[model samples]
Structures are given as structure tokens and as C-alpha cells.
Target: MSTPGGQWRNRETFVREGDGIVDLLTCKWAREHEYRLTKEVWAFRENRIAVHFAYEWHDEKGRWFRSCGNENWESDENGLMRRRVASINDLPIDIGASLFHWPQGRLPDDHHPGLSVLGL
Candidate 1:
């Protein structure tokens, strides 16, 4: 999703182990205003799918903020996200860093968060 007034109509999705290319666009739910995935780390364990990701967003006032955490996603044979349970941490970055993507030609700066260096 998205914010009530942000109008985040553009988006893309990537399936695991599938090219890793983010060219598939799907934004039917773009008007939801209050749901999204920020830092997704996932894996399969037996019959379940586990996920960990950070969620950062803005309030109705347009103030950007973040909450970091992990989650559990269970699916049926079709591999769809279902029955999600999660926990959230309220800690924001102690350092004011500019998050970036170096692989996309963004250069390293003193404020870099290093996610790009780790190939995230």
C-alpha cells in the first residue's frame, strides 16, 4: 500500500529466485494508505514461509519515519502470503544516514546506510 494522500501509483514486485528483476508492475492496492513491506528477508522452513523486514513510512502529516522488525508468513500450496504475524521495533536510525543504492550508480557518502554495499 500507500498513504491516504501520497498517491503512490507506481510500484513493482519480484518473486524469489526469479530473475530478481523488478519489472512486473502491480499497484491495484495503491490507495490503501497504510500497509507495505520495507526490508524483506524471507525463507522457507518445512511448510512455512518466514520473513523479516523493516517498515518505514510517513504519517498523515507527511513526516517520514521507520519501524524495524520481522514476521512469519504461511501459505498454502499456491505460495501466497497468508496468516501473517509480526513484531515491530520503534527505533529509528541513530545516525541520520541517506539510504541509497550503489549498484544503481548512487555513490557512497558519509551518510550512507551501507545496505547497497551488502548488495541488499
Candidate 2:
């Protein structure tokens, strides 16, 4: 993934390869309390896709936050993601304000409301 501060060389940007990417996700998942992700929107064309997403989580001190982000992805011929760029912002929320009330796993596609319907 090519986050901010990544540089391009030979048509490829700097990316966190292999274990670096794994470690990054591991650390993020490890730190958050009750993390939940909800995909808000997606647009696709050719070999690229753009996704708008939102997630809710709390810190160790019980402070809650809603993180909203957009991610642009480019895939290789094998359908593997070759590049990803993301932009994110976080907003502090009240302790009991979380909209996601489903169980601690994938949200049910038929029952759950998306971000737009929830006025996120």
C-alpha cells in the first residue's frame, strides 16, 4: 500500500511489502477496542476500484472514534492489488453513540443499513 510520504520510482510507488504489511494490520487490530468496519460505497472500472469506508473503535481509555476513509486500489493482471492509496479522518464520538450494533463479525448484508442510510 502506498500511503502518504510514498515515492514513485519506475512507475511503482513505495509499498509495505510482505511482513511489513502484515505487521501494520496486526498492530492496528491489536490496539483498537471493538473495531468494526462498514463499507459505505464502491466504484469500479477497468482494473481499478475506489472504496469509501467507515469504521468505529474505542481506545483503551474508552474514548470512541468514527474513522472515515477513501481507498483507491489498482489490481494486477492476476487480480491482486498492486497499489492502494488511502485517505482517512477520525471524529470523536460519545460512548453510547455507536450505530453498529451487530455481532462481532461480518455485518449481515440483508439486515444492516449502510452509511448513507444511517446518515453517517
Query: Any residue pairs clashing in model 2, and if so which?
Result: none
Model 1: per-residue Cα lDDT over 1-120, one tens digit each: 211221111122223321221222223223222333334456778546666554444444544444555666555455544344555564433224414223333243553443334343
Off by over 4 Å in 1: 1-37, 40-42, 92-120
Give the TM-score of each candidate.
0.44, 0.81
Find the candidate with the highest lDDT and give its number. 2
Worst 10 residues of 1 by lDDT: 1-10
Candidate 1: residue pairs that collide: 2-33, 39-53
TM-score (C-alpha) between model 2 and the true structure: 0.81
How accurate locally, in lDDT, is each candidate? 0.40, 0.72
Give candidate 2 misplaced runs (Cα > 4 Å).
1-14
